[model samples]
Each structure stands twice: as C-alpha cells, then as structure tokens.
Target: MAKKQDNTITWDTFSEGLWRENPVFVMLLGMCPVLAVTNSAINALAMGIATLFVLLASGTLISLLRNSIPKQVRIATYIVIIATFVTIVDYTIQAISLDLYNALGAFIQLIVANCMILGRAEAYSSRNPPLKSIVNATGMGLGFTLALLCLGVVREILGAGSLFGIDLFGPRFEPWVVMVLPAGGFLVLGAWLLLFEWLKQRKSETELNPASES
Candidate 1:
C-alpha cells in the first residue's frame, strides 16, 4: 500500500500546483479556453477568476464529502457539484454585464468540462482534508490565471495595441490583426511553450552544475 502523506505536506503540494505543475503552462491541461478566451485581457481575467472560484468551492466541498461519497459514484458527484458552481458563476457574470458575458460565450459553461477541476477532485480533494483541498485548488487556479493573463497580454498588445482595455500604444501602432485570429492564438501558445521548456532546461542544467558544487 502507498504510504499516507502527512497533512503538513499539503503546502508543498499546493504551491507546486500554482507554478511547478501548472495545469496550463506546465501540465498543459485545459488549453481550449486558454486559447479561445484570451483575445482580450479582460476576458481572460474574467474567465480565470470564474474558474478559480469554481475550483476552490468544488474542491472544498468534494474534500468534505470524500469519505461519505461512494468511490464508484464520486466522479459523477464531483462533476455535478462543479457544474452547479459554474452555472452560478455564469449567471453572475451575465447579470453583471451582458457584453462581458457574451464575450466569454459558451466558454463559461465549459468550465464544468475543464479537466483540472475533476482531476483535482479525484486526485487531491478525495485524498485530503477540506483545508488542504482549498489550498491546492487556489494554487492550481492561480497558476491557470497567470498563464491566461500572459497569453492575453501578448494577444492584446499585438492584436489591439491595448492591455486590459487601456491603450498603451498610440495611433502610430499598427495592430497585427492576425494576433486576434485563431492562428495567432496557436502561434503565441506554441512559442510560449517553447520558451517555458527552454527556461526549464536551463534551470535544470544550472542546478545540476552549480559553481559551489563544482
């Protein structure tokens, strides 16, 4: 049998989810929305925050019910919980502003389908206490938000000469219309992945060959 993890280890697990094993930049899970909704920084931020709220709430709830839930139906139960939260977020956004809600479109509802939420419920929440699950969910959600923000910044700057709806570049700036297109999303994401891989390799090499050790 696998050894049980100490509760203290939850912090490490939680922090790693935010950056080291980020679902978007590192693990590369839930790329569809990341690419689709990042045309503007506002949309990206809205989506990220919505996802974060759902993830935290669902994780905590799932962890609380872990023992009581039958193992066979746990996945289904978790999905239902997650879907309910997503629906709440969806309506909340719609009520706040129809434009923003329309900007996000079906992607808001699709949060229920995001693998990160379900994966967390099964892999982390089901195995840990409610507090730890909340921490983990927050970390993972933040990581996802960070990645989306990065993509949104890149796309918005190149496509619209703006950042979060604020014009940074003047009229002289000629926006690369393609940056707002589907092809541009893929290109930007691909380049970001390559950059991440390169940095990770460099970090690994530096750690392996530190001057003090040498």
Candidate 2:
C-alpha cells in the first residue's frame, strides 16, 4: 500500500497510481470485484470503466466541496457522494447490458466502499483543486483498468481460448478450464505481480549498471 498524499505534484499524484502505487498490483485495494468479475475481458473492462467513472465523478465533487464539509463527518460525506455515483453507474450499466449488470452483481454497489476511491477523496482530492483531483483520479482509474485488463486478457485467452468471445485459437485448441474459475483470478494476479516485480528489478539493474548505457 502507498501512503496518503497530503501534498505532491499533479504528475506524481497521477503517475504513481499507474506504476509505483497501483491500486491492485501495488496498493491492493478492491480485490473482491477484481477477483470475482474478471473472468473475461469484457467483464473486466466493464468493471474497470465503471469504477473509473465513479472515482472521477466523486473526486471532483469532493474537491469542490472540501471546504464546506466539516472534517469530523467528511468520511460519511464522501461515502454518500460515492454511493450516489455508484448508483448512477449501476443503473447505467443495467440499461446498457443486463447480463453485465448481473455478472457484476453487488460488486457494482461495493464500488462505493473501494478504498482507492475514498482514499483519494480524503487524502488528495479534499486538499487539492478540482483539476488536480480529477487528474489524480484519472490516473488511479486507468491504472486499475489496466491491471484488470491484464488478468482478463490472460484468463480469457487461456481459459476460454478467446478474447471477448471471439475465438483466437480455433476449434482445435483445448482450454484451461481452471483459468476461468475463482482460483484462476488469484493465480493470474499473483503471476502478474511477480512478473512486474521481476521486470522492475531488471529495469533497475539495467539503469544502474555503469557499463551498459555509456
């Protein structure tokens, strides 16, 4: 997990979420929806975009009203605002696709409690201007979406031999059934985290090795 930022540049706030402090891979927030809903690429994309909408919308509101809300009740206020947006998102998703809505289940409503959203609202948005808050939220949301897509794409291809329901492996390829199961989420996510760590270490070593870049 990352520390709550009281002060930082806009770029730092935004970029940190994409890599150093990703909500899922690094910070590990909102695992329920991540594990439960990412059985396919489309599902993962839907969930990610839904979360992004809620975060960005609520962050803007929290930043604009930061001065009016008393510190003592700010958490509750933030929840209310987030819940409002979540409801809107939930209904919107339902209208667009009932199957997606059912697949997401309570996880959509649960977005209101996602620590990543509330964390930004309290730690960064509340103390910053609306523009900065939106930028930071955008970063966090996109990072979250990217992480989701990573698992989703891997699972869909291996588990079902398809991406978004289009057959990539043709009819002959055998699918890994376990890849679409609940355990698959954990396995894939863990694999991705390890892969990222290895790559990060390699990049650091490459940068530090004096003879290579000269």
Candidate 3:
C-alpha cells in the first residue's frame, strides 16, 4: 500500500522543481534553445514566457487526464498536448508582432521538443493531483524563466550595451560584439553553471560541517 503523502511534502516537492531540480540549470534537460535564443535579452524573455505558457497548459491538461490515459500511450498523448500549445504560442506570437515572431522563428515551434514539458508530465503530472501538478509546473517554469533572464541580462549588457532596449552603460562603452555571437552564449552559460555548481558544493560542505565539536 502507498503511504499517505502529507501536504507539507507536496509543497516541498513543488519548490524543489523550481530550484533544486530545475530542468535547465540543474537537470540540464533543455539547452539547445536556451543557448540559441538567448543571444539577446528580448529573445530570451520571449522564449522563456512561451515555454512557461506551454508547460503550464500541458501540465494542467495532463493532470486532468491522468486517470483516463492508458499507461502504454500516455507519452504519445502528452506529446500531442504539448505540440498543440506550441503551435498556439507560435501563431499567437506571429499575429502579435512579426518582428519578434521572426526573431524567434523555428525556435518557438521547437518548444514541442523541449524535454522539460514531457518530463514533468510523465514524472509529476501523471501521478500527482491536479493542484499539486499545477504548482510543480509553475515552479519549474518560473525557475526556467529565472535562468533565461540571467542569461539575457548578461548577454544584452555585454553585447548591446543595453538591457530590455534601454542603454545602461552609455555611448562611451563599446559593445562586445562577441557577446552577441553564438560563442558568447556558450561561454556565459558555462560560466554560470560553474558558479552555480561551486556555490552548491560550498553550501553542502558547510551544512555537513556545521558542528565543529564533532
């Protein structure tokens, strides 16, 4: 028999999805787009929002249909749900702003292939209650947004001398052209990952050695 889960545990599960087990920074599930579209702050923000929308929508639908879906075909069903939302977001962006839409291009449609969405559906949404599943999905989406925003800020400031379309360092500071290139994306992401890993390791060591008397 399965042990009854406490409400507090559910909250922990949800929170962990956001930070501790983030799909991008921690699990590193979806990196192709994260590195490709993050060349500019605007592009990064747009991709993050689009991903969040798809994750939430797909998670909710999957949770709702968990009981009805057969174990064998669940993966296929979840993929279809995800693909539908990706198409909706893609067309919506095209209709709203052709420039932004063109900037995103095939990357927007590629959200269908993002492992985070399907991973959440198969791992959490399929087994958890609807409310809990939504919370988990939201947390994971927010974590992804946070990571993207960090990358965007770094790239934009160095590459364009501006952030979100506003110049921050003024005219005297020449933009580093490399920051706007693909190589810069890889460099920035690699450095950030290294920093995160170092911090996490230090935290773990500190926690383990908290009591000097031992």
Candidate 4:
C-alpha cells in the first residue's frame, strides 16, 4: 500500500507513526529496550531520543541511496548505516553522562539490531523520497519514544516515588519497589497494551456507529 503512493509528504505519513502505526505500542517492534531500559522516565526518554536520532539519520541516508543499491545487499547496507549512527549515539552518551551511559548499558549499542529502524529503511525510506522519509521517521521515532515514556513514567512514579529522579510524593510515600524491577516492565507494558487495545476497539465501534458516540 505504501508503494502505491507518489511519495508525497502528508500529515498521515507523519502522524501514523505517532498513533495509528506506532512502532512500540501498535506494532510492538523493538520490545527489548522498551522493557529493559524503561524502568525510569529519564532512561526511557534518553533511549527514545537516541533511537529517534538513529532512525532519522539512517532513514534519510537509505532513501538517498536506495535506487543505486542492489536489492540483494540492501539489508546489509542498512545495518551498516544504522550501526554507524548507533556508534555516534553510544559514544556521545558516554561523553555527556557516564551515569546515563551506564544506565542504558549495552542497549545503546543494540540499536543497530532494532527492527524498527531497519524496518523503516526497507519498508518506507527505500520506497519514498528523503523529505517524506524524514517526516515519517520523525513520527515513528516520537511514537516509539512516547510508548517508552508511557511505561517509564508510570513505573518510576510508583516504584520510586519520583519522576526523572525528582521526589514527587515525599519521604512518607512508600514506593512500590516492584515497579523498578524487571517484572515491573512486564506489568506496565501489559497494562498499557490492554489500555491501547480497549481504546482502539472503542474507536472502531464509534467509527462503525457514529451516533453511538454522540
């Protein structure tokens, strides 16, 4: 369906990734970092931004070179391109803040293997112009980042009584403890998935019977 388009930039192309086709929430791609590194809002935000950068950079480059590349070697080329950007992010993070760098750990390097960026390269960028690809990548990256924040913010607030390390409640507030654990990632992600699913279903019903919403 995407290939059928004339590669024009439209709001749908950008907004689809933010909601309708969100990489994390809707498509469930790149769950590794989504669940592993999102225990805190800061970590989630940092990871989201990093992924967004890689996506935008790699997508733009891939779109420019798409026509010249052999179809058989495209995937390898995509990975190399993605890895170059990931390396830049990984080192930049390390130089900026060792704490954040350690917090994210190997997951930063793993962005190379993230299916979300590669999928965009193969599916959207390769078939579209650079401008359209940039718009699409921006939306998709934000969507993925938003999904991470959804899980991270809730988990951090409940688990640590904080948001981005700021104490929200007080010393009197007892943290959930579990919210910061590996298990917390699963619980939060599950709850979010259910909520999004319900919302989607409700939207479908409303669209099918417009009067019902009124």
Cα lDDT listed for each candidate? 0.89, 0.89, 0.86, 0.92
Best by lDDT, which number? 4
lDDT for model 2, please.
0.89
The regions of model 2 sitting more than 4 angstroms off are 1-10, 209-214
How many residue pairs clash (N, CA or C atoms closer than 3 angstroms) in each of the candidate models, in the order given? 0, 0, 0, 0
- Residue lDDT tens for model 2, 192-211: 98998898778877786745
The count of backbone overlaps in candidate 1 is 0
- Give the Å error, residue 82, model 2: 0.6
Q: What is the TM-score of each candidate against the true structure?
A: 0.93, 0.90, 0.91, 0.94
Q: Give Cα distance to truth, residue 86, candidate 2, Å.
A: 0.5
**After superposition, which runs of candidate 4 have C-alpha atoms over 4 Å from their true positions?**
1-3, 210-214
Q: Candidate 1, after superposition: displacement of residue 91 in Å?
A: 0.8
Expressed as tens digits, the lDDT of each residue in 1-214 for candidate 1 is: 1135877655666677777688998787888899999998999999999999999999999999999999889889999999999999999999999999999999999999999888878888899888877887889999999899999999999999999889988999999999999998999999999998898778768795645421
TM-score winner between candidates 1 and 4:
4
**Candidate number achieving the greatest TM-score relative to the actual structure:** 4
